[model samples]
Target: MKKSYRIKANKEFQHVFKHGKSFANRQLVLYYIKKPEQTHFRIGLSVGKKIGNAVTRNRIKRYLREAFHELEAGVEPGYDIVIIARQPTKRMNYHEMKKSLIHLLSKEKLLSKK
Candidate 1:
C-alpha cells in the first residue's frame, strides 16, 4: 500500500479511535471515521505485543496491508480505518486474516458491493 493511503501519525490514529464507530469479529477490531473530502481510504494497523514476538507481529501487519491493497477497489473511499488484530490472529494465515477483516468491514458497510 502507498504511504499516502496509510495512517502514519499517532495523532491520526487517535482521531480515528476517538471519533470513529467500531466493529469486530473474533480476530480483529475495526474503527472507522468518514472523511468525505478524501479521495481514497487510509488505514492504520495495530498488533499488540501481547499477541506475539516482533516477527509474528510484523507478519500480521504485512498480511493486513496486502489484504487492504487487494480489497482497495471494493472498499469505500473517504474513510480512515484502523484495524487491531486480536489474539486469534496470531494463529491465522493470510487468507484467514483477510477473511476476518472482510467480515468486519462488511458488517459496517465499508466494503462496497462488488
Candidate 2:
C-alpha cells in the first residue's frame, strides 16, 4: 500500500485498539474506526513476535499489506483499519492470507458485497 495510505503512528494503533470495532476469522483480525474527516482509509498491520522471528513476521506483514492493497479500492474510504495476524497465520501462504483478510473485512462490512 502507498505510504500515504498507511497508518504509521503507534498512538493511532492504540486508539484503534481501544475504540475501534473488531471482527476476526481464524487467521486475521480486523479493527476499524470511522474517520469521516479523512478522505481515505489508513491501514496498519500487526504481526506479533510469537508468530516467528523477524523474517517470518515481515513476510506475514507483507502478505497482509498486499491483501489490503488489493482490497483498498473496494473498501469504504473513511476509516482507520488495522489488520492483526493470528498464530495460524504463520502457516498460511499468500492466497490463504488474502482470503482470510477478505473474510474478516467482509464481516466488518467494509468491503463491497460480492
Candidate 3:
C-alpha cells in the first residue's frame, strides 16, 4: 500500500474511529466511511505493540496489507477503510488471515460479488 493512500495521521485515525461505521468478526475490526470521489479506496492498518514486538507487529501488518491488496478489486470505491488487528490475528497464519479478512469484508458488504 502506498503512503498517499494510507490513513497515517493521528487525526485521521481518530476521525475514522469517531465517525465511521464499523463491522467486526473474530479476527479484525473494520471501520469505514464513504468518501466523495469514486476513484479508489484509502486504507489504514492498525497493529499495536501490545500484539508483540516490532517484528511481530510488522509481520502482521504485512500480512494484512497483502490480504487487502488481493481483495482490493472487490472493495467498493470511494471509501476509507481502517483495519484494526485483533489478538487472534497473532495466532493466525497468512492463509487464515486472508480468509478472515475476506470474510469480514464480505460481511461488511464491502466486497463485490464475483
Candidate 4:
C-alpha cells in the first residue's frame, strides 16, 4: 500500500482506537473511524511480537496490506482503519487472511455496496 494510504503515526492510530468503532473475527481485529473530508481510506497494520519473530510479523503485515489494496475500491472512503493481527493469523495464508478481513469489514458495513 502507498504511504499516503497508511496510518504511520502513533497519535493517529490512538485516535482511531479511542474514537472508532471496531469489529473482529478470530484472525484480525479492525478499528475504524469515519473521516468524511478525505477522499480515500487510510490503514494501519499492527502485528504483535507475541505473534512471532520479525519475519513472521512482517509477513502478516504484508498480507494485510495486499488484502487492503485488493479491497480498496470497494471499501468505504474517508475512514481511518487499523487492523491488528491475532494469533490465528500466524498460520493463515493470504487468501485466508483476506477472507478474515473481508468478514470484519463487512460486519461493520465498512465495505461499500458496490
Evaluated at residue 66, the lDDT of candidate 4 is 92
Q: On residues 1-114, what C-alpha lDDT tens digit does candidate 2 reach at each position?
A: 778899899999999999999888888888999999999999999988888999999999988888877877888889999988889999999999988877777777888864
lDDT of 4 by residue, 45-80 (tens): 999999999999999999999998999999999999
Go through the candidates in order and give the clash count of each: 0, 0, 0, 0
Q: Rank by TM-score, highest first.
A: 1, 4, 2, 3
Least accurate stretch of 10 residues (summed lDDT) in model 4? Answer: 105-114
- For candidate 4, the TM-score is 0.97
Alpha-carbon lDDT of model 2: 0.88
RMSD to native, candidate 1: 0.6
| Tens-place lDDT digits, model 3, residues 1-114 | 766668888898888899999999988999999887748888999998788888888999999899878887888888889999998889899999999888888888889996
Give the runs in model 2 whose Cα sits over 4 Å from its true position: none
List the candidate 3 regions with Cα displacement exceeding 4 Å: none
Q: Which residue pairs in candidate 4 have backbone atoms (N, alpha carbon, C) closer than 3 angstroms, thus clashing?
A: none
Q: Return whichever of 1 and 4 wins on TM-score.
A: 1
Number of the top TM-score candidate: 1
What's the lDDT for all of these models?
Answer: 0.95, 0.88, 0.87, 0.93
C-alpha RMSD values across all candidates: 0.6, 1.1, 1.2, 0.7
